[model samples]
Target: MKRLRSKYTKGEEVKFISHLDLLRVIQRALRRADIKVAFSQGFNPHPRISFGPALMVGATTEGDYMDVDVEEDISPHEFKERMNEVLPSGIKIVEVFEVDVRDSLSSRIKGADYLVEVFLKKEVEGLEEAVKRFMAKDTIEIEKETKKGKKLVDLKSYLEEFYLIDMNGERAKFYVKMKLGEGSPNPFHLLKAFNEYIGDAFDLEYYKIHRKNMFLE
Candidate 1:
């Protein structure tokens, strides 16, 4: 068996697919490409493929990683070519390489960087100042509903970096870096918290969020 790691992109066309649907799409593409992916041992065997942290539905990604185990030795170049030939539009394999079978993508990913563009009804004054004050606070708490019950979580604790990159009339852009994995705050929720913090300064019309990259340990 050979383990391969790949970096790929999720474009606008597939941004709305759920993580489970995305997995099915990849598995189907592998089958159409005639790649012999290894299956887990059991009565109900499943493909031995795994992905890094799941991307939120409606968010596009520039660089996402996945690891797959194949039954045959296939060169990374050939694998990439085959997969691309069958993958639907908006999903493209960017790079591939061999990796130690034991290494897992999920465990190595530390955080993710995102580019967010918000469309507002109108520009509000002191927007930058509000962001500064929000970030300067010792704690920013938001209510999160978990399986057990609702709990207050410190949004500031999960954020490594965040700042406004640009702001024009009715439009604003931000760059955010936040922890990934269990208990990590969602970017959308973070934005909601920010909006509230500034006394609802953002009369948000809509927003576009794109994941720029993942940081690995």
Candidate 2:
């Protein structure tokens, strides 16, 4: 058995695909490439492939990672070439490498870095002051509805990094990092909280949002 690890990009054209549909596409590509992927032993056998954390819909990502177990030992370069030849547009393999079975992409991921570009239709005074005040607070509590129910959660603790890159009258850029694991806050949720705190200081919308990288501590 051989374990292969690959990094892929989800471009804007394919960002609408759900996580399950993305998995199906990859499986089909592997089959078309004639790669012998191992299957799980069960009543309903499935490929022995695993991917990192699920990506939110409408979010483009360049740091997505996946691991697959193949029955045949194939060189990483050849594997990449074969897969790229069959993969549909907007989904491309960036890199492939042999990985130790003991290691997993999910366990090693500590956080994700995102670059958000916001466009402003209008501006209000004291926008910067509101941002500073929000960042300075001891805790920012927001209500979220989960399967269990609506609950108030503190977002301050999960923010590993946060800063505004630039903000003109018409546009703004933000760089943020949210830690993963227990109690980790979603980056989008944090942005929503920021917008609410600003209280219509600026009519802001996310023009572009891209996940730049994922890191391990």
Please tell me which predicted candidate would have the highest lDDT against the true structure.
1
Root-mean-square deviation per candidate: 1.4, 2.1
lDDT, candidate 2, at 71: 93
The residue-by-residue lDDT of candidate 2 on 141-186, one tens digit each, is 9887777888898888777667778888887778888777644667
Model 1, runs deviating above 4 Å: 203-205
Judged by whole-model lDDT over C-alpha atoms, candidate 1 comes out at 0.89
How high is the lDDT of residue 149 in model 1?
89
Mind giving the per-residue lDDT tens digits that candidate 1 earns over 37-76?
Answer: 9999989999999999889899999988999999997999
Q: Give model 1 RMSD, 1 decimal.
A: 1.4
